[model samples]
Target chain A: MNTSVNIAGVCFKNPVTTASGTFGSGKEYSEFFDLGRLGAVTVKGVATTEWKGNNCPRIAETYGGMLNSVGLQNPGVDYFIKNDIPFLRKYDTKIIVNICGHTVSEYCEVTERLSDEDIDLFELNISCPNVSAGGITFGTDAKMAETVVSEVKKYAKKPLIVKLTPNVTDITEIARAVVSGGADAVSLINTLKGMKIDINTRKAFLANKFGGLSGPAVKPVALRMVYEVNKAVDVPIIGMGGISNTEDALEFIMAGATMISVGTANFANPYATVEIVDGIKEYMEKNNIKDLSEIRGIIE
Target chain B: MKKFIFAEVVEIKHMIEDIYDMYVYAPEIAKNAKPGQFAEIYTGLGEAILPRPISFCEIIKEKGLIRFCFRVVGKGTKHFSEMKKGDKLRLLGPLGNGFEIPDAPQKSIVIGGGIGIPPLLELCKHLKGEVHVFLGTREEPILVEDFEKTGAIVHVCTENGCTGYHGYAITLVDELNIPADMIYSCGPKIMLKIVSDWAKKKNIRAQVSMEERMACGIGVCCGCAIKIQKKGEDDWHSLKVCKDGPVFWNDEVIW
Candidate 1:
């Protein structure tokens, strides 16, 4: 059975890629499972400079999920090129670097710096909800989303995939905006904005007060958004949010996603990605489905 | 590479009200465990999605066993309390950078409060020089005998003065006029802040173990970040408690 799905001109061995920031450049999770088993390893967001992120108490456990305000803490592009790239090169999977920044130039600087790197794709992150300035600014606005994508596309040598945030009024408008600019594909939904309060202390649980929520609770909304964006745009959609099992991945695919990403579930079970991969293969055999294209949008 | 092992529960004992001591037979984990390192204990409950991170109270390398002492705080710890002996627990560990104990024979004062007392036991047992342990709790003190077993001078403090000293653990040190070349501490943020302030005023070096709600006990999830200052840098950088440290020099902390 053919499990491979091509986004843009790049071909992933399978449609299973770890979501950005959840998988730390394939170093920590490599302990439980091999990096090569994945179709692609999407590294955490890298910026033009090192980001200290927010203060402590940055994460809180919510019902059926969790909230985080990690603020995209990373060691910058130089460190990623020196340390993380060499480690990930040892694996056979495709590398999709997620780029984050405070300004449009900051995003282009990272893309330009990584021009000579061995990465297969770039997931331009204008959707991070934790930061105050640039994270959700570009994603929530239609004109801004198109402007950032077009600006980054000029510098990026690899295929550019725009990651969309779900905290917007209308997600399809932003999806169509990015596709109108020069995006090869699109991935959604990047965590919904949420907050948790400590009753005893009468204060917010997270230090940042507001955080991005991800997990099983957000799956239904993600599927609905993916289905709507697929119908609205001509680009391949990478659906993710609260994807825990093979059935969840299948749901995203059936809802018209070309691929699916596993995020918060990795914290619970490190072997979840590989398990879903095997489960997808098992499902194909049972249903006599030859390729993923047959079931890509079967519900429609 | 880090390995997750299924450790069989060898023994479980109720140390005090709501506190439990569980001994697990995990050779691989026990073989490499250090003083301040912790393990992520899987609760096996669907409601509790993330693993609860618990520190190693003791490590008997000869028997290939590790002891974890924890209080039943939430649903996760409650699940651990219900577990029976011989049951296998999926544990991911011996993670995080542990306490650094130099063999220079310096006078060391180890201060721990409530649940924070457990990680210090391993450090006290291994320290070669003069070690004085001061532990404080809200009410009933757990693992006092275990601390005494380490052969260090153990002092206790409770909120109501029902045990050893009155008030906080730092007050005990102040009343005794304890002279120390260094201090090691782990407790609630407020207590640690007091201890850190005392250490700074006295010009004594101190290393503190910090706690945060963690997701991946590994560095992947940037959930457990603690602000820290580098040796020569003036700027504070967010360091992962699970990777950079559960233990950091008191001066490095931004508290």
Candidate 2:
């Protein structure tokens, strides 16, 4: 009957939260459904300063998935503290701020600035592949990931969930690295690097030429990586990528995700997160399941 | 509030090669929808995840119907063109800001190129002034009768000289020497830029509806960001075409 999940002692009302970058601090989607229904609202990446992002044509639709090279366009942590925080505080949901930066200090600067804010968790985004510096640069390399997480951990007051990129060869190595560097929990996998070309134009479909692919297409790879990371590390996993319906969510849960984040599905269905939340409860009631733990990583 | 509903397809018509007109019965959307606003239509195909953002060509509030006139550009639109009447489509809409209508009667010029012509039809119908419509197409012009039905002065220009005036619609506007207090347009970026420039030269207020490759038709995904700067601003900011506007003041756009 219990649906609440605790990650690093911070309890989410349910095991459903939106993926960062997909849900913009729960502002637009808040118009569709009540924000309080979500376990947590993960805001977009906030840096020390505002980012202008890439260029037009930043997104392209592919087979069962989409590619985005938004480059973490944000209004900075100060803007979040001034505008987003107060707005989100009006809701009853937990706030998980996703922090992004170009360097180790930049990440710490944002974390230190937000350390005093009334938020629930800090999702350290060391896995954004769209940016040229400091994002996937730190996430793909185990040593860099450890260094960035440790550096940011010194400043972050709340539980730090290091988001991982799926572009790496061994995702578990990076998972172990972040965990070793004082990460309270970890979330994976971020978008996988992918590209599409316009056959008529003979040019890259996305303005950046390459973008991060997220959707149902990436779900299998994300699930495999989540399972592998779960086996390799003791930290709770927040699984994501291509999670649209409750069944897809349950697959991630059974694959060992402590909490699942809905990404690209939100675009396809604005009510995707809330629907999954309700669907999970309905599923549990129908199956006579007591708690999510009964199904969490049950496949193993 | 935007509603994601299963709208029953009322009618689908193949107006021309690659272009089709689809009408759906969704009272909630039809009641709330304004001209220039768009709907995110899901293909129902599992392979295509993102919905195709199609603008409302017409909103028949009396019958609780909304028409989407779109060309078969890609997989999603092609799928929509193949849909039959009575088929239910997953639609999320009344999204993005629509064109602003002035209160007082004034001279207005509405320009549209190719597929962009459909969105301007509703705006023309709702305008309270002298409406001058200039439609530009490659070979054949569609929606001439629809615009004509609105009682607006409709002018057609074809690129191939197959019909109407020869050359682009903007040139037709120049040749006709049509004077207006405001101008509105929707088309390819290059065409919009020309319209924006033409509006700037005349010192008239102008609004343009932009198009971009979009994932989410909502502002959540900063996918369809268009560079914009206010009149006095030094630097441009990335504004979501889905949320801030698929419609923006022509002068504010960093074209």
Candidate 3:
């Protein structure tokens, strides 16, 4: 029988959480199901500077999944900390707020402000492509990744979990760069950027022309990254990509993820958040395992 | 908030040349369904990633069924068109707001252009007396025969001069000069606008259902906001089409 393990001293009741932007503050799903049942809920992405997000046609649907180019259209960090945090604190489950920044200083600034709050953990979103810079830069380079993690880690009084973007050349290098820079844990596989075109109209289906693909379509890629990063890092890994079923969630745990987050699948089925949490418990019971830690990194 | 019960396709009736009548067995929503509310149905083949939003044409709760009429346009509707008897579709419905007809109208003139005809079909059931239905299409193929089952005085306009009263629908309405106290219309946006203008000029009451790029279908996404001219307000205000409408007073819409 295994018990819960500490991640940088932040205690998680369980190991299941919804990915950022996938779960809308947990209130919407609460109408259909109870939110407190889940171990954690990662709210929508929050950027250092306010963003309006992309233009129209920001979303599209494909087989077993959907694409979203919300482009992190969130109220600025100050608003999230001041207004959103109070309501979020009421939930029994832990709050692991996801934060994104355009520049390295912005990351530090947001982290420093968050350091004094009674927050649980801060997940750094170095993964998002910086739109104003005219190129998808931040996640691709090791030096920049290390710089971002190190700076944010300095002011992040809470545990720091770096979310890795999959658009990089080598997933392991980016993971190693952040881990070496004093990050406590890391989340793998933010959305993979993609685009689709309409042949008849000869135009892009999404207004932004590109979106991050999630759901069953990207599960294999997400698994590979989780498996790779689990091998390369000492920190805990929060794995997510196209998780719609119990078997898919188990795959991430077996691949060495300490916890997992569900994204695109929630849209098709709103009750998926707590449903997956129950699923994790069912798996542990069936396997005769007393603790979920026994399953992590056990994959050959 | 209703449970999603199984809805079987009892019969796939080809009403018009390209249009189909997919009769379903949706017990709960149908039993409590109201006119103007729509349902989201999974195209039998899963060709459409999201369920196609179709307004309920007729809800016969005694038989635990509702009917939807759709013209084959894109992949989803075309695949749904191929469905046959005994096919089951997972449907969630009786969604969005419907038109609230006035307490009294001397003569009701219902205008339906192409796909818009199906939604107004159910209105005839709730309304009293004989209604004058003005139906229009580009040609005879898109015109349906089942519309006459309502027993209303029907008029049609075909662009190709192959149908009754050949010409634009507005022309037929203007020429007939029917003394309509209220007009409920649904069609392509342009047609609805013209009908609204005509109703405005004629001093008749009109209600319109608008369509837009919908995401959640229920609401919440904020994707479907239409500008509505509010009474005494200087600026046009935004109203959620999915929740506040799909149905609105004809004059309130900014067009």
**Which candidate leads in DockQ?**
2
Model 1 agreement with the true structure over B1-255: per-residue lDDT tens digits: 666799999999888889999999999998999999999998766666889999999999999999999999888898888889999899998999899988778788999999999999999998877788999998877678888888889999998888888788999887886889989999898888889989998898888999987788899889999889989997988888888989999888898
In order, candidate lDDTs are: 0.91, 0.92, 0.76
For each of the candidates, what fraction of the native contacts does it recover?
0.72, 0.90, 0.08
Cα lDDT tens digits for candidate 1, A1-300? 899999988888899999998989988888778889899999999999899888768888877888999999999999999999999989989999999999999999999999789899999999999998898999999999999999999999999999999998899999999999899999999999999999999999998999999989899999999999988998998899999999999999999999899999999888889999999999999999999999887776
The runs of at least 3 residues in candidate 3 whose Cα sits more than 4 Å from the true structure, single-residue gaps closed, are A1-8, A46-53, A73-91, A100-119, A124-137, A141-158, A180-183, B43-49, B72-79, B82-84, B100-113, B123-134, B141-155, B165-255
Tens-place lDDT per residue, model 2, B68-104, is: 9999988888999999999999888888999998888
Best by lDDT: 2
Chain A only: give the TM-score of model 2: 0.99
Task: Report the poorest 10 consecutive residues by lDDT, candidate 1 chain A.
Answer: A55-64
Candidate 2, residue B81: Cα displacement in angstroms equals 1.2
Evaluated at residue A236, the lDDT of candidate 2 is 94
TM-score of 3: 0.80
User: After TM-score superposition, what is the CA distance of residue A53 in candidate 3 from its true location, in Å?
Assistant: 4.2
Q: Order the candidate numbers by TM-score, best to worst.
A: 2, 1, 3
Clashing pairs in 1: A215-A242
TM-score-best of 2 and 3: 2
- Candidate 3 lDDT, A1-300, residue by residue in tens: 443445778777777788887675665566566666777878776667666556556667666555666567666778788876786777777888887777778778878877887678888887764255412366678888888788888888899888899998899999999899988999888888888787888998777787777777889999999999999888999999988767888899999998889876665555666678777778788889998777888988
Q: After superposition, how far is residue A40 of candidate 3 from its true place, in Å?
A: 2.2
Looking at model 2, residue A233 earns an lDDT score of: 94
